[model samples]
Each structure stands twice: as structure tokens, then as C-alpha cells.
Target: MIKKLKLIDSKFNIENKVGMLTFCRNDIRNALTGSCIINDIINTVEYINKNNTVSVLIITGEGKVFSSGGNIKEMLKKNTSFSGPVEEVEKKYRYGIQQIPLYMEKIEIPTIAAINGPAVGAGFDLACMCDFRIMSNNAFLAESFIDLGIIPGDGGAFFLQRLIGYQKAAELTLTGRKVSASEALELGLILKKVDPNQLLQEAKKFANEIAKKPKNTIRYTKRLLKMGAKLPLKEFLDFCALLQGISHNHKEHKSALKNIKRKM
Candidate 1:
């Protein structure tokens, strides 16, 4: 049986502030249930958002599969997880697993997904939600919800399209095909592919490079990128001006300018 989700606080090269969330249910390939959604993912992101000391968050699974997504046994039995009439089921989705992405959006820190193995169904969407992704050479991704007679319920439609474009997202979702690690890189879905044993190590190194920069600037830059992606050009420029004002006044910015002058 699966036990629990584990949160780890680690540093890379003694500089980066990193927080890791591991899916500890190795026995079942970290198949997600209602409890894991509420107690593990959503709750953990809440804490990570509050912890200003952490500049980056990395998510991974303990075993060969990143996650199997939903519990098949629960679906078969019409278990409380997905049970009830149509309206009730709709409400369950709105109030349940949907909260994961909603909370994930609120996090100011950058998130990196270290895919150590295959990520299927909603698991694929979960990795897409991250700001960056690195995969194990042995890993792959499958939008396998079509096989279950269901659609992407956990924001995969939105996330996947934004990452890999409409054509590729449609093909993956409709066909339920697996995209290998090399293909993921070629398709611009992941950053790098490494051996399974080095997945976390490389991810930490990547996170450290990002974390070494000004923390507040990194957070604000991420916020700007998200807003810019959806906002009108004029509105995005206005938003950038406002954030730039704040960034210019930050101590880190001031320190960097002073160092530049000294070198000059």
C-alpha cells in the first residue's frame, strides 16, 4: 500500500534554496487519490507559497512512474472520488483536483518538474504545470485520458496547448500516445534528458542557477511572463512598467549596479 507524500528542503552547491515534493506511493506508481490531492499536493503548495526562503520547488515520483494519475480501482467501483450523479461529479472536480493547479498558479517561486519516469494521464498535466521540466532518459509522457473515455479534466487542455502548441496537444490527447524523452526535448516540452539516477541531480543544478539570481526579481519576472502571455500588448507593457519600478528599488538590484560601477 502507498503511504504518504514527502517534502524535502535541500540546497544545491550551497547557494540555491530548493524544496522538493516526492510522491512516496512507490508501490502503485504514485497513483493519485482524493486524499493525495487535498492533503499532499494542494496542501504542500500552500506551504511552499508561504515559505519565502525557498526560491525553487521540484516535483518527482519515487519509483518508475511519475504518477498513474487517478486511481483506476476507485473509478471502477464508482467510489466517492468520482461517484455521484453528473452534477455532483462536476462539483467534485471543481472543488477537488482542480484546486491543485489553482494553488500551483499562486506560487511565486519557480517550479521545476524532474520527471524520473513515465508520466501518464493527469500526471502528464501535472508536469506541464511546472515552469521548467527535466526528464530521465528512461521517462516518457502520455496523455492517456482518451483510453479511459474521459477528457483532460485537470487543466491539461490549457497547459499542454500552451507548452507544445495546439496541433501536438490535440494529437497527443486524441491518440493517447507516449512521447519519449528525446522527443520531449525536440518538441520543446522538457529542458534536458539524463539518466534516471541523475534526474534530481541535474534538476537541482538547474534550479541553483536560477536561484542564484535576485529572488524577488525572479518571482516578479515569472509573474510578468504569465501575465504577458495572456494580456494585450499595451496592458502588458503597462504591467511591466509597474513591476520594473519595484524591481529597480530592490536591494539586490541596487547591489548589482554598485558592483558594476566598481568594476568599471
Candidate 2:
């Protein structure tokens, strides 16, 4: 078992192959900055990637907020994370908080974000980075960088457009409004919205269902999905055919087919 993390609580269930990570910085609504927690997130993702027993990762926040995104106070004071000159600030962003999205993009394990409360600004972008999102009915989300007189610095513009399409992404990012859970569902931003009390339970249940599938198949399927997002139709279809051939030869696929035949 891996040791518990400081800024994040990591729980792994070996029997079910599920890993849950809770962001514990409720003091500032889990606000993010160009701080050590960026490394913490990268390290956690790397740890989960290396653990073969863990096929899924669940991310949530403690208390009433998932994350407030960037530390606005720091920006206002031009201190702590935002004190440097323009060139220095650019480097800081490149080497610090930027690593989270870059590292998270590589994890092959299925990642789910269980949004327990308000996810604003970069916080909402973090959730978008995950493969899936499950929100508490009481939770809300906002691409609120515009409200702060800034832009989506952490890939919100790109990620949100991919998730919900360009027009809607434009509306949210441009308006910088808080979107309620029901509106999020209507926009196809989340998979499900359950009661706050049932958020983690429902997310874990879904993770377990996915984890029960053959691990290699899940990984390959996830890869294909990522590829499908980036590749042209013809190129994606070619890659899909090749991956399907490999999947057909997998022992897990063979066993599943055999069971189906036996039942028939």
C-alpha cells in the first residue's frame, strides 16, 4: 500500500482495483496555485500509473468546493505565485501548474472526477481533464476566468470545447457564469448528478464496474478514445481496425466469447 499523501488523501482498494484521491485543502475552497501541490498531483498520477492493481482513479475535493482554480489573491497581490516579471511568470507557469494537465493526459487508467461542490476557473478545467465526471446535485461548475479579468490558462478552452462542443464552450467561457448541476447535465458536461451524500458512493460504484473489465482491454479502449479525439475520421478508423484485431486475440476477449457460447 502506498503511504498517504499530505495535500491529498489517497485510498486504494486492492480487491476492486479502485483508487480514490480527495483534495484536502478546503480552507481556500481548494484553491490551486503555482505551489508544491502541482508536484503532488503529478506524483500521485505517476504512482497510480505504476500500480497495476489500480485500474481506475477517482478524484474529489473535501468540504464544499472541488477547487477554486488559481489563487486569485496571489494574483491580486502579485505575490507568492504571481510576483515575478512577465518572462519569469511564463516560466513559472510552464514548469509548475502546467505539469498537472500534461502528466494527467498520459495516464492510461480510467480517471473519474467526482465533483462534490463548486468547481470554478481552473478547477473546472481539472475536472474536464479527467476521462469522466460525476457531480453532486448540489455542486456547480464555472469557467470563470473571464470574471477574474483573465483567460483559461490551464487548457479550459481546449478541453471544454472537446467535451461540450465549441458553441457551448464559448458561451460558458465567455460569460463566466456558474452552471448548476441540472444545466451541466443538459449540456452533457457530466455523466450523472447524484445527491451530495451519494456522490462518492455512486462514483466508486461506476469505477468498480469499469475496473471489473479486463484491464488491458480497458486501457486499449481508453487509448482508442483519446486517439479518436485527435485523429481524422479515416485515420481513426484505420487505427480502430488495427486495435480491434489486437483486442480479438486477447485472452480476456477469448474467455468472454467462450462464456457467451457456453451460455447460449
Candidate 3:
């Protein structure tokens, strides 16, 4: 178990290959700033990745808010005398906002973003990076980066377009729209929406369903999905065909086929 430095005791539950990460930062609506989230996200992801015990991870916020984006108060104070005259602070930590999304995207294990409330800017991008998202009926997504006079530093452009289409993605990014839960569901931005009170429970149910599957198949599928974005159709097909051989020999795959034959 990796010890996370700044969290409130890492109080979460896990069983049968499903882990829950509750955002403990009750302050600032669970803002994932450099100091507050660096160790936490790293530890959470590492714990899930290391333990094959956990096949899926679910993330939710403490109260009504999922995340309020990066600490804008902290960000805007960079050049101010109150922020101190350290150039490294701005250069290093300003860039650190990019890391959380990078880590989220690189996770081999499946992830579920349980959007309990508003997820804006960095928060929205983080949710977008997840394998799937289930939002509360009261929850909303805010692509507020451009509204804040900044371009999204994360892989927002890449994943957003893939989730929705290019035109819709562009509209969201350019207009900095506050997309409601129902609209997000209708547009396929999220898997579904549950009542605010049942958000976490719904997320747990969703994750448990996915966690019951063969892990290797999920990982391979995620890889192909990522690869698909970068490769031509023929090349992607070739790669997938080559990759299928390993799964063809995998024990879970063999067992599934054998069980089907028995049933027949």
C-alpha cells in the first residue's frame, strides 16, 4: 500500500476487484491542484495498477461538487508578490496540471468517473479521460479553460473528439459550454445519469459489472482503442489481428470457449 502524503487517511473501500477513491479535499470543492493531488492521484492510480485484485476503479467527490477545476486562486497568483518571486513555482506546477490527465490516460486498469456535481476545466478533462463516466442528474461539465483565458493543457482535444464527434468537441471547446447531465447522456458524453443521492452507488454498480470481466481482454481492448486513433484502417486491422493471437492462447479466453462448447 503506497502511502499518500496529503490525503485525509485514504479512507476508501474495495472488494472483488473494485476500488473507490473519494475526493477528500472538502476545501475548494475538491480541487486537484499540484500540491493537493500530486501524491494522491499517483498513489491511487499506482495502488489500482499494482493490485491485480482491483480490476476497476471508481472516483467520486466528497459533497455536491465533483471538482472545481485546478486551483485558479493559486494559479492566478503566480506572478503576484504574495505567490513569492520563485520562477520555478509557476513553470513547474503550472505544467503539473498536465500530469494528472496523462496519468489517468495511461492507466491500464479501467476507470469510472462518478461525477457527483460540476466538473470544470481540469476536472472536466479528468472525467473525460476515464474509460466511462456516470454523472449525477444535478452534475454538469464545464469546459471553462477558454473562458478562463487559457487553452486546455491536457489531452482534452484528443479524448473529447473521440467521445463525441469532432464538430461537437469543437463546439464544446470553443464555446466553453456548461453541458448538463441529461444533455451529456443524450450526446453519449457519459454512460448514464443517476439521481444525485445515488451517484456513488450507481458508479459502484457500474464498476462492479466491468470488474467481473477478464482483465486481459479489457486492457487489450483499451490499447486497440488508443491505437485506432493514430493508425490507418488497414494498419489498425493488421495490428489487431496480430494482437488477437495472444488472447487466443490466454487461459480466460480458452476457458470461455470451452464453457460455451460444454453448454452447446
> Quick one: best TM-score, which candidate?
1
* lDDT (tens digit, per residue) of candidate 2 on 1-264: 765544443233344888877777777677778334566678777777766678888988879999888977778775566668888877877877778789879888889999999999989999999999999999999999898787887777878999889999999999998999999999999999999999999999999999999888888888999998889999999999999999999898999999999999
TM-score of each: 0.91, 0.90, 0.85
| Candidate numbers, best TM-score first, in rank order | 1, 2, 3
RMSD of each: 4.3, 2.5, 3.2
What digit string (tens of lDDT, one per residue) describes model 3 on residues 1-264?
654333552346687778787787766778877335655776677666666667888888888888876777777665531255557545554556666777786777888999999999878988998889999998899888888787776657877888899999999999998999999999999999999888878888878788888887877777788789899999999989977988898998998898899999
Clashes of each: 0, 0, 0
Q: Which ten residues in a row have the lowest lDDT in candidate 3?
A: 2-11
**How many pairs of residues in model 2 come into backbone collision?**
0
In model 3, how large is the Cα lDDT of residue 2? 53
Off by over 4 Å in 1: 1-15
Model 3 misplacement above 4 A: 1-12, 79-95
lDDT per residue as tens, model 1, 1-264 = 222334322112223577777787776677766335445776576665665667888888877988878777778775576888999989988887777688778888889899999899888889999999999999899999999999888888989999999999999999999999999999999989999888999999999888888778888988998898889999999999999999888898999899999999
**Any residue pairs clashing in model 3, and if so which?**
none
Which of the two, 1 or 2, has more lDDT?
A: 2
